[model samples]
Target: MSIVLIDSGLGGLTVLHEALQELPHERYLFFADNGNVPYGTKPKETVRSCILSAVQELVTEETKALLIACNTATSIAIADLRRLYSIPVIGMEPAVKPAVELNRNTGKRSLVMATPLALKETKYHDLVNRLGDTEHIDSQPMPGLVTLAEELEFDGPRVQAYLQETIGDRDWQEYGTAVLGCTHFSFFRTAFAKFLPPHIELIDGNRGTVRRLQELIRGREEAPDSAAAAGPVVEFRHSGSDPAYRERMEQALDWYRRDRERAGRPRA
Candidate 1:
């Protein structure tokens, strides 16, 4: 059985990339709803519908688990999807809990950078409220970053300029942690590191999400229906008919691979 990862666009590749490192032998089916890209800025109902439609298209008897890798989609449709599916349905959330913990006693706040719609969702708010660190948590809408990532604009003058315009004015010293609430934002880690204060650390939920997936997969490893491939394989699909999206996904994966290698962390 294949593990399914769904997102509106290329953002979920970040999570998929992480999974590749840890679950190198697992089969993966990555479904990108490229036809309805940028779920972040869309209406809640519209985004939820798009996510459900994509999930419906991807989930099958051969699917072992489902991961909603987009923060916006997770915020809007994860609960409904979980109710409808018996598979291990995992969803992404901002790494707010860890970020808050990191900032504790440091007199520094944790900044959450995500899409506007995600930040507006009650799920996001309730997460923050439940943490009971409202005073030390701040959120910024980064819809433009999603667009840039979809366009494969990782780091360049345009990306730098956009980052500067969006967050340059902030008092970086007041923030000890920056939670990448959107998966797309992970692609811009280089740009953010160059722009944000050196003291500010970046955090994301990809690792945690992948850990949850590993747990689910482990639980089913001995099941009678469990299937294993000769090696890890990733099948990329999208809602759009364009073949270019497949190439784009490959390119993004290559970029991530090269980036990790440069950081002395080669793929498993």
Candidate 2:
């Protein structure tokens, strides 16, 4: 069966990218809600509504399974989405545990750069809890980061400027391992490297998320062969965000198309 991945913004494709790499033989669809970017900051109820709407769209659009690639949305609404719809839903929790395990093996400190909501939401109680707030683990609030992600999506100049403005005055040099708590944050890895030393580590949980999806797919008897033609295509659905935001999102998507074509790479 075709796999469908849904994120509140374009960042979710980072997870989709890794999933495809592991299962290149599998057909897939990736949907990013660029219009509703930044689900982390929104209320739980609002996130639920938007996520439900997206799942409904996919169901009507003929997708078989759904992966909630956005961590914030997953933290808040994954269970409800599963209950409301028959489609299998996969959720994302912080990858701190894996990072911690990696750090202990490598001898490095772990610091998580996630949004405020991610830190505050106890509903995200399902956290792997592998690591603690010990010296190895540092969680901080960088709220407007999704905005920075949107900027990066369109190659906006504010990207570098925004990073410098946010991190220049701070001391991020202390941590060796940095967990990109949000999916969108994965796209800004290059810019983040500019601010961090080369030895610093950047860890993301997209791969783990994909593994869960694989397990779900395997359990489904009706699931289609991943080798079938990849007909599951995804698009942005801006329910009620700013018009300017929608325009910028469309432009960024166009850029993705052009770049993918030039590189002879399939859109992830």
Candidate 3:
């Protein structure tokens, strides 16, 4: 059986990249609903409906697990998905607790960067309250970074402009860590580093989600018996019939590979 990873656009590709490295034996089906891109800007009801429809269309009988890789969709639609799908459904959330812990460890402030919808979600507020004081936790809405990541223009002038505008000239030295609350933002970790001070750490939910999926897959005790077992494979699909979709995805994969190689890290 394959695993399904759903997102609004290229954001989920970041999650898929991690999954490919850590769960090399598993087959992945990445569904990008680019027709309704930027779920973070949509209304809660609209995002939920779109996510449900995407799941219904993408999931197959062979599907063993579903991972919602968008923070906006997960915050609003994850419960509905769990109720509807019998398979294990994993949802991506901001790494607020982890970032806050980093702050405590370093005796510096924690910052949480997310889309407007995620920043306003009750779950996010509760997470902040549980992990740290509201005054100490800095939550900012970064609605444009997702679009930059989708365009695969990381570490460029456009990205620098956007980060400068979004982050302003705040005393970044005061912050010890920044939590990337959106999967899309995870793709541009290096760009974010450029805008922040060197001491500030960056954390995201991509690796955590991959680990969670691995744990669930192991618990199921399922073995690969299908044709896909011959090798690791990733299937990409998008709601919009964009002719450049395949080309862009290939480019993204290449970038992912280069990043790993430059870091001198083997496949996780």
Candidate 4:
């Protein structure tokens, strides 16, 4: 069986990457809507439409389910998509529940790092409310990191500057646990560690996503390929106005994978 992980940009790759690590045998397909890289700031209607169209185009009947690997889309668009589509839909959520659990003893305020849209979305608000507001959660929106992550394939100093400027004194030295609310943010986990103390924890929501998907469709068997070895091959495509720019994006992503593998950054 095949599963499709859909997102508006490279951030979804983080979830895709993580899922591959956990569910090594599932045949997978990942489609990044790079034309609309950052979905956090878009209007609800626009984001919904974009995601719906991409999902329809990529999810063949042969696919087992869909994983919306984006926090902004999950918070705003998932419910609507589930109603219209018959396939199982799994989406990313902030790691507040676990972060608060770990933060109890350490007393460092729980840190939730996400895109501006993720922090402001309806689902995110509902999550906080569901937790009863008792936990001391510090929500920090790092918009520059994503914009920088896209360029880190090319510009390192710019990305570093953005992180240094954004994450000042009250960082790893302070927060007990930091949750990666955005799938794209997971890609820069290494650089993030540099900013955070060795003791601080960086957690992403991807592995949980895989476990949930496994529970949702437990006993099903399709093609032998689904139960075979995992191949972490990502096909990059761009629908931008500039052809050269699209090629550059693919090259950059390829470069990151190569460098990450060499640096011994864990890969799917």
Candidate 5:
């Protein structure tokens, strides 16, 4: 069986990266709505529509679950997805809980940096209220970070400038941790480090989200040894006419391949 991962763009691959690390035995299918990238700024209804359409197009009977890897989409439509689909529906959230926990004992402040909708949505507000100490949780809405990730500028002057422009004014010394609320933002960890102090930890939901997926799979019957030994295979689909989108997807796959080879892990 295969599991489906849906994202507004390439950002969700960060989650897919971790999923491959933790659950190498499962088949993974990824779908990106590049035609409508950056769901952060879009209207809630539009995001829901696009997500529903993607789910309808990519999910099949062989699919075991749907992982919504976009933070903005999770904040807006996760519940709707769970209700609409029969299979397990997993979603990502900013790692506010872990960030808050990391600072709770010391009474240090923690920051959650995300898109405007994620910060304003009730899903995040409830998450902060339930799992974190509200007093130490600071929310920062990053407007253009997603677009920068979409542009694929991983390092150098452009990323540095973008980080400096977005977070340069913040009192970086005060926070003990910063939760990366968007998956795209998670990809620019080095850029974030240039602006943040060494002591401030950066956290994201990728690993935790993948682990939860593992836990959900534990309840089901195991795949045959032949299937498990075959390892993970990622099938990609993009709902856009842009050739650049396909090229970007290929680049991401190649990066993963090279990293795995460097680590001496067996290829799928």
Candidate 6:
């Protein structure tokens, strides 16, 4: 049994990276629906169907829990997933609540960078509305970052050009924090930190999501047995099932590891 992390592409590796750091003893199954990659641009029903189909293919009696690591997929299909599955179903959302709290009384807004489909979702809007800080929440659709991440372009002249083109003109002084709403965007945190004003802090939901998974797993009635205790191992799979793509997944993980090391961020 393993905690399953699903995404449209390699973005969920960000979540898995965090999980491995925090819950090092647990096994993980990372499923990337790369055959139907980029769910952020698709229609709501289409994204939902793809997510449901992929989840159906991945979930099993041995599956411990499911984490929809893609913000776009979570916005579109988390409800259906929760209803259909008995295991704990965790979903991603922009860390708007914490961003809002952090900016409270700071006279600064939070800039949320996500994909078009995710930003357009009612779930995203409802979250901002529920927080009652709609005026202070700004959203920018970053569909390109997902493509760049899938291509393994984390940082370079091309990445810098893209980031600059997207946000170069903005007045960073008006924002207290920038939220990496999409998991793919987390890959470029280093780039974002360097480009944005030093005053603006970067935030994401990856750590929070992993913490939720820990709480749920610990709350479970069953005790850890041999199967559960066997691993900090990760089994990677994708809808495409291409050996090349699997290699890319491994490469992405390695990239993330190196990125963290370069940033001097603690792994555990």
Per-candidate RMSD vs. true structure?
A: 2.6, 4.6, 2.2, 3.2, 3.5, 2.1
Per-residue lDDT tens digits of candidate 4, residues 1-268?
6788888777776666556666666777777777887887778778888888888788777778889988888988899878978878999898888877777776777788898888988788788888764457888898776776665443356656767787765746567778888877876777776767777777778778878888876776554552364454444544445556556545555655665676564321
State the displacement of the C-alpha of residue 15, model 4, in Å, after optimal TM-score superposition: 1.4
Estimated TM-score for each candidate: 0.95, 0.77, 0.93, 0.85, 0.91, 0.95
C-alpha lDDT of residue 208 in model 3: 84
Q: Quantify how close model 6 is to the true structure by its C-alpha RMSD in Å.
A: 2.1
Model 3 per-residue lDDT at 267: 17
Best by lDDT: 6
Q: Which pairs clash in model 1? A: none
Error of 1 at 144 (Å): 0.7
Candidate 1 error regions (>4 Å): 222-230, 264-268
Local distance difference test values of all predictions, in order: 0.88, 0.67, 0.83, 0.73, 0.82, 0.89
Q: In model 3, where is the ten-residue run with the lowest total lDDT? A: 259-268
- Which of the two candidates, 3 or 5, achieves a greater TM-score against the reference? 3
Candidate 5, 126-200: lDDT as tens digits: 998997389888888886878777777655787788777877888877788988889877666766766788888
lDDT for each residue of candidate 6 in 1-268, tens digit (9 for 90 to 100): 6889999999999999999888887778999999988999999999999999989989999888999999999999999999999899999999999888889989899999999999999999999999988999999998989999999999888899998899889988899988999999889988887788888878899999999999888855355567657757889898885779999999999999889878865211
Give the Cα error of residue 96 in candidate 5, in Å: 0.5
Q: Scored by Cα lDDT, where does model 4 land?
A: 0.73
Q: Please give the distance, in angstroms, between residue 223's alpha carbon in candidate 6 and its true position after superposition.
A: 6.5
* Superposition error at 33 for model 3 (Å): 0.5
- lDDT pick, better of 3 and 4: 3
Return whichever of 2 and 5 wins on TM-score: 5
What is the per-residue lDDT of model 2 for residues 1-268, given as tens digits with 9 covering 90 to 100?
A: 4677788766776776677566665656666676666777878788778888777776644555788888788877878878877767788777787677766765577777777667767744335343453656767666666776676543345667766665566555655677888877776666666667777767778878877777877756454454344533334445455667556555655554454355443111
